[model samples]
Target: MLALRRSLIALVAIVGVVAGAVTAWVVTEASDGGAHATRGEAAIGGPFELVNTEGETVTDQDFRGRYMLLFFGFTSCPDVCPSALMDMSRALDRLADAAPAKLERVVPVFVTVDPARDDVVTMAAYVENFHPRLVGLTGTPAQLRAAADAFRVYHEKVMPETYFGGDAPERHEKGDYMMAHSAYMLLIGPSGGYVANFKHEAGPAEIAAGLREHVDAS
Candidate 1:
């Protein structure tokens, strides 16, 4: 019940610095505060067919006109998933008063890598705890795999018995037993291409700063 309040800057800062390592390259790729390049190998790619909490046929196209903050995780994750989402929610809320329409322009998403267990119903219930606007999506195994591969997310099923070296249920089942996954926060522009990326562990303020920069430009 405490997680929903969450949270980015301007155009050139958002679109142009496709490079996480090179400052000049970012300048070249983007104008004063806008991205100039059309397309490149980015965090946004691949096609997916998943259903949103509303049970609608949610696909990548649904976000055509807006910025998308996408993350790969599940409702059952014990550590990274909840912590990150909570931080994100809190960060977004702090920015709300400053940029009333920013949240509307940039949507946050939570997609379960474990679709077999994270169906529409479960995903829906879980996301609502974090933020009213956070969307949860899931689908058949096939859909899940496609999305994961596209995003370079890695998840492995470790049976409960073998999950931990033998830890408590609250420690293992809620965590170690769950699928091991790669966490990445992605930003997709209106054209459905990767423009920036915030790896898992990026602070909420950093994430909010990134989003603010990118969303304002678009």
Candidate 2:
């Protein structure tokens, strides 16, 4: 749980840098802070459909035979999203070197919470910044919301005061908003059930270690 708190701290810091009007408390309040907690498997993960970067429709069933490391964020997220993707890539690379066979059974997935701005092409380009095997997914707002709910992930957009020129509640451009979401990397079992999760503070080595432990146990 401490690790999750740390992840939230880093996410809030990134949001603050992008939109000075955001505060750490605002982000903390937005997050449920229990994404990676030990809860009933029923509490997380379920059926959902979305489009991959290749414009192909995918679902939880498509990844049924492999472990899924999922992260929810947006392409517009300047720091947390990119950093988490890089961490996932590095963790996968470590796994490939240490346990090649186990690595083959793991899949890293990125699902965009802000689908309005992240289409198939945008997700394709954004995913390229990380691992070659990473799958980037985006879909309609309703579709994305379904997936987020299935995962019990929290996400919401905040219109920063800076966009309003320091005026309180003034109208701003539609795209001038920041997202506050959970920043944990969720690990789903091969059967599409909940396994465990790694907080951003865990970094590459810790993430790789967690994957190795879970994959070997199964």
Candidate 3:
């Protein structure tokens, strides 16, 4: 009886050690920047209601299971917006072409700041020029302000173009207005929290490299 009792105790001890080791491994992986931390810290992911390019309602919960790259810009912007989209599309293409499976796990999101100018039809037409997988969103001015607030972005319309042209104001396009804003892209994980936010002003290769760096690390 004594021998049997000792054997049972020893078996229990072994199991305890094994379980402890497994737990440590899991914790390390979850915290490792070199690993794609599932359910990462709560910063980026949250409930949001946005209008899709199709004029349909899209909520934050719709993107619960994929990595999302979100950018805030307007279609009417003279330069930054289009250039950023093009760069992002190229990066995604490179990532996809390299690893087809990654395509299923990644989603690119574009949120327009000038909702007044980016109606469903307008946003749709702009998105169509980019990759087919790209998604565009815009809503009411209230919705826009709310979303921008959530992301902590600054954007406003500017007027009085060329007012200082030697007292003879240059002719404006009448309907042409410029958006004063900054360009940056936010990257989020499956947990819907921000993992990385890279500046959209970066060159395509740099942006792509940053993405690859993170993906590879993860």
Candidate 4:
């Protein structure tokens, strides 16, 4: 009985050690970056159905056979959104200057987080402020939410009272609001899968270099 008891205790100890090792491996994988990071297919980018500035319904499939430079922001965003969009536009221009032929292989997309105020006409005019080839998209709340979820983009409307030190903006009405959102320029492959993303701090040259690397790889 004593020997049997000892054997059972040893087995249990072995099992616990194995479980601990597995858990540690998973944690390391989750935290590790560089080549060890796990990037599964369709993990970052997923299917989404949205309406373009032209008032036409489109999906991820529509942009298939070409790369997509996707960005999510609202027209009312005064700083971060505009800076990122400018960087994206200049990146494309740089790429074009180096290899004009590569321009046709990629499409720059702007998705609005505030669809309530960003209709087709608004998006059309907003996109014109950036690159001519840039495409702006908006849709219903449900559609926008779905797209945001797929891309892991977070956005929320900030009331006027929250804009300053607990003081509302002058003439701010009930409907007046601003948005707080994640600002990252996502790069989708020609196969409609996520390739990479650039932070808003990345300048035009850096973004262009990174984008050029992907285009060359493709």
Best by lDDT: 2
The lowest-lDDT stretch of 10 consecutive residues in candidate 1 is 1-10
Candidates 2 and 4: which is better by lDDT?
2
Residue range 77-162, candidate 1, lDDT tens digits: 76678887887787678657567677778888888888878988898889988977898889998888898776556666765454
Candidate order (TM-score): 4, 2, 1, 3
Better of 1 and 2 by lDDT: 2
Q: Which runs in model 2 stand beyond 4 Å of their true positions?
A: 1-42, 161-175
Computed on alpha carbons, the lDDT of every model, listed in order, comes to: 0.69, 0.78, 0.68, 0.77
Query: What lDDT would candidate 4 get against the real structure?
Result: 0.77
Candidate with better TM-score, 1 vs 3: 1
Minimal lDDT window, size 10, model 4: 20-29
The whole-model C-alpha lDDT of candidate 2 against the native structure comes to 0.78
What TM-score against the true fold does each predicted structure earn? Answer: 0.74, 0.77, 0.71, 0.78
**TM-score: the better of candidates 3 and 4:** 4
Please, what are the lDDT tens digits per residue for candidate 4 over residues 77-164?
A: 7667787899999998998897676777889999999999999999999999999999999999999999987776777787756543
Cα deviation at 174, candidate 3, in Å, is: 4.6
Model 3 residue-pair collision total: 2
